[model samples]
Target: MRKTLLTIAATCMWLAGTTAFGQGKTCEEAAPWSNMAMVMDLASYADGGAWYKITPTANSMLPFSLTELPTSAVQVFKGCNGEKALVMSEEVASGNISYYIESGVEYMIKLDVSQATGSFVMAMATPLDLSNAPDGNYCVKPINASVGMYSSIKANRPTWFKVNIVYPGMYSVGSGFSVPAEGAAVTSVKVKSGDCGAVENSSNLLMPNQVYAKAGENFFCVTCSGDMKVLFQMVSPVASCPNHPERMTALSAGVEVTYPNAVYENYWRFIAPETATYQILDKAPQGTILQVGTLDENDDAKFFCNFENGLMAEVDESGEGKLLVDMQAGQTYVIASETFNMLAEGVPSVKISKDETGVRSVSGSSRDIKVSKVAENEYRVSSYLLAEGAGVYVYDMAGRAVSSLNVRPEGDAVTVKLAGVPAGTYMFLIVGRSKSASTKVLVD
Candidate 1:
């Protein structure tokens, strides 16, 4: 069921004699001595207020205060994208306010002093320093850090950091993943070069990585709203990360290898010598997961199969993290651990194996459904074999949604019209009530 969030303006009306939309005694209307900008940092004080504006590129959660005690009632307001809303007005007022600021919007911070005296104290500090994180780099394993975004709403100050690597190898940050906001669809946790540096200068083999870890100084940070904490740990590297993973040596079929569990996350490059469907088998202790994905020429991993996270093809129910994948020979495949929120447990060794038989990349679920372009801006979807309804969703190479259509079978197939779309290559994902299938389409 879909629930709509009700946002009622929490405004207060304070008037001893006169009547107006705003309080009779406001910080802006009161004498200069009545309102003071005591501080501009949330890491220090809990009482004070300041004018805030949305950061240029990112969303901000500006923190502020109203009164020290719930002794009076006055209406407080917060703004978003230059629009203000009644934050809260209560008989007792003493608490913090978090303003969800939109980029490019200027907002005002005012106190209500009609029913009771207004307190002025605000705390918002920069880079909310992590202990011993000079130059914003943490050199040790299981490093924890916080990017204080809730207090830095008016400023686009992203918590930045670099790892002082004692050794050089591919690494991955584990556990304690930072969330931008509750219920947000997408968020990123990554490592880059020195503070906010370019991707190429990153010490890790993969820039902006989520699962793959690097053992080098690849700086790590998160871009999101609210205060967040992330955990970092070094990971084993696949020997190949020179931008082109395909050039790396490929693992032969039917080979089982014992890898150390010391590295929580491990990466391996597998090159399919021919078109085939393959299963990656992990015989490690229970709960050890296996992730596999195809990398482009630039070594960028696509939405491959992740059995551990249950985001892709289903693995065995025993929870050992076995995954099936299909790809052409010469394709670069990289596999990593999808561990979250915990350290690697006792696994004597990670046993890895694969069996393959050449086939197409279609799923057994959507085998009855087929999508193909019959003409420009027009495609044909046939689902005569399906026992249920289906829909087609278009997505870009990076997995961002382009559009979707609720397709009904006209006889044995349905025709979909997608006009005015620019020329490009996109992945077409077909969804049934219970199962789904995906295929790539080139638009001209």
Candidate 2:
């Protein structure tokens, strides 16, 4: 699943393109600069040095400038708004964070830490001066399967974050390899296994909400007890998709969608100025229909019910015998259709009524109607009495039965006075000899 990515910083100067330089002679010599790139084995908890740091093939760190803030600083400004921020991480233990001299003004400058401990670089809106900023450095404190780090800035900006525990399970690191637990509710991911190589090239190219691991590393392994659980040390939310993944076609509108159908007087639907088209699609143990309709005209806005398949299902769309209808707003109309064994991709059709003022539809599918306000404070119950004799029940939203009524109504109609009911929303059910129908209604 793909999600929208948001820029979390405001300083544009930090993001400005900088010429790539080579790593300096040593930490003693280059301690004043930020480390551009490195890969570490976070799983090695035995020795803090077990995590190896690689010098950048070329220096990618943005040099601190005084003329104007770097575009990358924009991220710091946005992080203050309560969104997550990316900070810088160090691979070596003795590296020092050095500040450069600029103008006479002092500013707090640094990366913002994410919920995960990993450091990220982003642009910030505020221009921070390093010349007078406080002099404080931070480091990652490692513990077995537990992540911890400390950070501080000259001012109130959140400069540090850390994870308390890291996963310590064996996992398989390869393409198309997934390490999900059985029945575990999958909420988010930081990487896809197949795209490991791309992550190495550009750390920002990983997908959001994915599980990721370093390529060619022991991504997964088994415990001595033979129980297997995938262990991930830490994951960053920064996702980079170079290909610009495909767009998802959501179910905006389509036929055969699972929905309640209650049209006028139990017929399918009818039309006048509107158009509708219904076709029987699948019928194995049961028969299902797919209907597509549109508006015919802008003036006429009422739907009719044939009472068989449907009666005059008129809508605004132009065309004959179509399901789509355009009716004036705010009109009361009645639609009727049968309930099904289960709510599959198919449901009963919707019914609308025609009026000169506006159009209104029936109160959807109702197996039973829990009348909350039949007469002011008093309430009555009713439902679509399709079967000759059906058991009807009414309940509140809390699943408590409000009333019970047996019905042998005259042709799909039942009117029972609910005595002393409160004003609220209620649910109703109509149970046939074997099947049942249900719907909700509000009583003012």
Candidate 3:
């Protein structure tokens, strides 16, 4: 999986071809600097370091890396919004992180400088040559086996991969590997036997230590008792010809969905625009069991929760589909569906909608506007002092402006009793010469 690599920090002060040098290192000083290439001599600071704040380009996969001059004294922390951060130390040298930094969002990188021999360099990796494939498994035998090319742990059993060790010297887990299990480390990586039988010629290699092997075809099986993420590593110099990894194309909210008519299984993805309860309605009678869950960067289902409430249908009866979920903002939700038997026609199409009654604000505007449901399918929009060019407009839950509420000022406050739209909740947008505001109004 090709994820946005964003593990890095830098504050630039460039003079065309000139670089800024620093000695007194402290995060308090570096906190205010803009993201640019910088060099600091941490040898003078002794144990002091600085924090580099980076607000990367939105929706871009920024690949960044850091390399210490002599020793590994850099502790990089990843966090935001005053949350406890996951710290990385060992992966700084000759390692990288790909992150999709949201546009105009600030990320803090705290640098804890320790064993600085003399001086060190820090640079934000920009203009990445992504024409190279990402780091992962390559050149394997038996291309049809699920256990051949980069295998994920299935249950508590060991997974195996056979790599043609042409330039084999040492192999260890790379920086792209994930280890979420508490205290989860490489247990034992050694040669595996053919078929479902005893062990063949095997040599166990513990993690953090690269194992040496002769140049030939080698078979290795990774066995970790506890559940953890693992990947194949080619620590030797022969690792080349990288292919750009396949990425998941995410679906955005508030858009009509296209029904999938696959024979057996169907898959989809969506990104929640905000924290709200969303409904996926089945529009046909195929009796499809809809399942929603979280997908890892590999687009693999990680975990799924029971629906708080979902509509059920009989074998041939129509389904009043309603799968409600509290989706978190910016999180990706995976959707999959299955049925007792495949249906060639009338394979239900799904629709997603959010309840607008509790919708606080969509567009963040400063103008004070009030909205209230008065009668069935009627709403009253009022403003104390309207801007010169202030105009009130009504929009459906999908944000398509349906009607305009023309409010002639009565006195100090301006009120418009408008109705005659479809029965449902609607969002009111007030746009003026100098400002704007959004409010929700419900109609029975």
Candidate 4:
């Protein structure tokens, strides 16, 4: 919306204490309202009234207010070219007013003062543009800690925003603002889903504003009293993770990794070369507490190791803790490290060490399992534990089961054919009634 300054003078004629038409007194002579305060000389105009034109650039809910209007009435007309129709009328001593407006439509506002004396201040709010904002439902970007949007809200008016959810998860939506006048505050924030006209599901979000949202669109309505400037913010747990390949680093066992600067959170991608148990140790400055967790294919929290749990030990005086877990070969995993305190400025450093206790066989069985690739998408498996009802399962690196087949032994070995399977590194597990053996295989 563009801003413009407009001022008009009216010359009135009075005969036998009766009012006459003058400039800015009729529909055709109405001055344009351009988001600025207009001063009126009530004694110079007939009936102590003035007319103004309002034309919006987009569909908006305009909030306007009249100050020091002790004895006044406001009327809104739909059309301007002499075919005027009264749409709304309000009688107020002094306060805010709101009306819905459509794009490219002409409207007129008539302010009448019954006292026929002094002047009053008129203010109108501009429609905010949220096209580039990440929190909007139609926006394609995601919001982080560094990005936040701001807008103003008027008293007794509702501000609407469409919240866009790209990834379904728990999120925090919060607002911060300053109250410049009495009764000026943000009252409530409501979230709704489904049809905007009909409420399918609606809920109010209070302080510590946390909400579980699905991947789609949601409507947010904010109501406030008085006029205030608000800062809107939205954050997700996965916002700190490296979303691209360039931001993520590889993790290998026995290598100590360190970041350049202190960060709230950091992530690393790890692929196991052999099936075994590994221990991760965090070494940082004293008084630093870190939360270690793992993410799944959907980037959701798969597992977390905390000080309260036995999987992770408490930080000692030297600020050292260990997390022990077992990993399978040919499987991928994401490790996430986050700090509880934002004030802590120590950089993150961690080292992963493989346990020398060796791989623990399934069901305590010591059966030897061997897998060898022979042809395209074909592998030969030889296992002593193969028996009736024994089956082989194939899983991709992400631990998603892709194929399963029942095996029929021919002599001592069986040939497994993966016809439609894509070329990738996969884990093959042979399971019987009492025992199971697994091996990693690469398909060309």
- Number of the top candidate by TM-score? 1
lDDT of 2 by residue, 1-444 (tens): 123222323222233322122212222222112333121222222121111112223212223222122233212111111111223322222222222222322222232112113332222122233333322221111111212221211222211112232221112211123443444221222221111111111122232212323222211111111212223434432211111111111121133323222111121222333333222222111111222222122244432222122222111111112232343333222222222222223333333333333333422233233344445445444444433455455555433356655443224544444556676665556655534555556655
Backbone atom clashes (below 3 Å) for every candidate? 19, 102, 12, 1
CA lDDT of 303 in candidate 4?
A: 36
Q: Candidate 2, which segments miss by more than 4 Å at Cα?
A: 1-378, 382-429, 434-442
> Lowest-lDDT window of 10 residues in candidate 2?
240-249
Task: Output the lDDT of residue 132, model 4.
Answer: 40
Please give the RMSD to the true structure for each candidate, in Å.
Answer: 17.3, 28.1, 22.6, 25.7
- Measured with C-alpha atoms, the lDDT of residue 337 in candidate 3 is 46
**Candidate 1 lDDT by residue in tens digits, 6-78:** 2222211122111222221323442221222232122222222222222223333344444432222211222
Model 3: per-residue Cα lDDT over 1-444, one tens digit each: 123232221213232223334322544344532433444645544455545555544423344565443223332222322221222112444655433333455555544445433365554545222224222221122222221134454334545555564432356632244544665555665542222111233334434324433333445555555656555555645321111111223445566565434322334566788898876655543333455565434336433322223222112234433456678888766654433222436545656678555643322232467776565555556565343434466655432346653232222233344555667656665644344455556556
| lDDT of all predictions | 0.40, 0.28, 0.44, 0.50
| Model 3 spans > 4 angstroms off | 1-36, 40-47, 59-104, 127-444
Off by over 4 Å in 1: 1-61, 64-103, 106-238, 244-267, 271-277, 281-423, 427-444
The global Cα lDDT (0 to 1) of model 4 is 0.50
lDDT of 1: 0.40
